[model samples]
Target: MVDTDSVTGTAKELAGKVRGAVGDLIGSDRDSVEGRARQVQGTAERAYGEGKDALRETADRVADAGADARDNAGRYYARAEESVRNAADEAYHFAEDAYDDGGRYLSEGRRAIAQQVEESPLAALLIAGAVGLGIGLLINTRR
Candidate 1:
């Protein structure tokens, strides 16, 4: 496309030169001046077309770079998301194991307390009263 425009402009320039020469030979100053103006207009138009072509090419390159950058960013985000999901899954399993261990410990503690209460009712009552007092004090402090 650029080559075609360049060729057309060159042809126009040559035609203008020939017309100007003919007008000069015929002693027509107006025709000669008009031919010169045509030549100048053709040159300006060709320059404008070249500038436009350069700008268009630059815009296309920039767009292609932007698309590549976006694609790379998307890939990175997907990988990061997968890593976070895997980490979350591992944490969930760890928490479940900890909960199971805590439950077992609590069960054993409850059994020991029951045996002690059964062996000594008076001691059990005293301990229960002490625990209640401590809880009441904690509540009062919060208030």
Candidate 2:
């Protein structure tokens, strides 16, 4: 594509140069000046087009590199998120096991307390009455 444009621009420049030479040979000053101006304009335009093409190619390469970097970052972020989720799941299971063990310990303590209470009914009754009397006194004091 670039080669084609270069060749076409070169052809146009050659044609303008030929036209200017012919005008000079024929002694037409106006035609000679106009043809020369056309040749110069064509040369400047070709150079500008080549510069623009170079800038566009550079911009495309930069954009492609940016896209690749973004894709790599996304992949790394996904892996990091998965790692965090797995860690959280393991922590949750550990907490659940600890809670279950605590519940079992509390149940055993309650059973031991019940056995002690059954072996001393008279002591339990006296303790309950004392607690009730203390609550009544507290309520009366509040009033």
Candidate 3:
């Protein structure tokens, strides 16, 4: 990236040198002093331009670094969101399986109870009465 200020300053500096040489050859003190001043001004201008270019380069690098950090953070956020979604899905599946197993266990227990009742009606009736009495006693105790 060429700086226009630097190029202009360089051109001005060269012109000043030529002007100073001509003044010296012709014995003109005013022209020589003016030429030297112009040279100093040109040097200052070139330095200012160089400094500006350096600052611009630094700013560009900082901007690029910020963009990279933002992109990385976005990727990390997406990965975290996916991980959370996967965990939620796994938890839901686990709960569903447990619920199905619980239902199956309840149905099997009812079937076994029915079978026992069919095999021994008198025994089942006595057991039912005992269970009812036990429940009644527990309820009265709480009251």
In order, candidate lDDTs are 0.63, 0.62, 0.67
Model 1's TM-score against the true structure: 0.40
Off by over 4 Å in 3: 1-65, 141-143
On a 0 to 100 scale, what is the lDDT of residue 113 in model 3? 98
> TM-score ranking from best to worst?
3, 2, 1
How many clashing residue pairs, candidate 1? 0
Candidate 2 lDDT tens digits, 1-143: 35343455566667768877987899755455556655654554455445445544554555667887656655655565455456545544554555466567768988998988899988988999999999999999999
Q: For this target, which candidate reaches the highest TM-score against the unseen true structure?
A: 3
User: What ranges in model 2 sit over 4 Å off?
Assistant: 1-67
Q: Please say which candidate is ahead in lDDT: 1 or 2.
A: 1
Residue 26 error, candidate 1, Å: 2.6
Residue pairs in candidate 3 whose N, alpha carbon or C atoms collide under 3 angstroms: none
For all predicted structures, in order, the TM-scores are 0.40, 0.46, 0.51
- Prediction RMSDs, each to the true structure: 38.3, 39.1, 39.4
Clashing pairs in 2: none
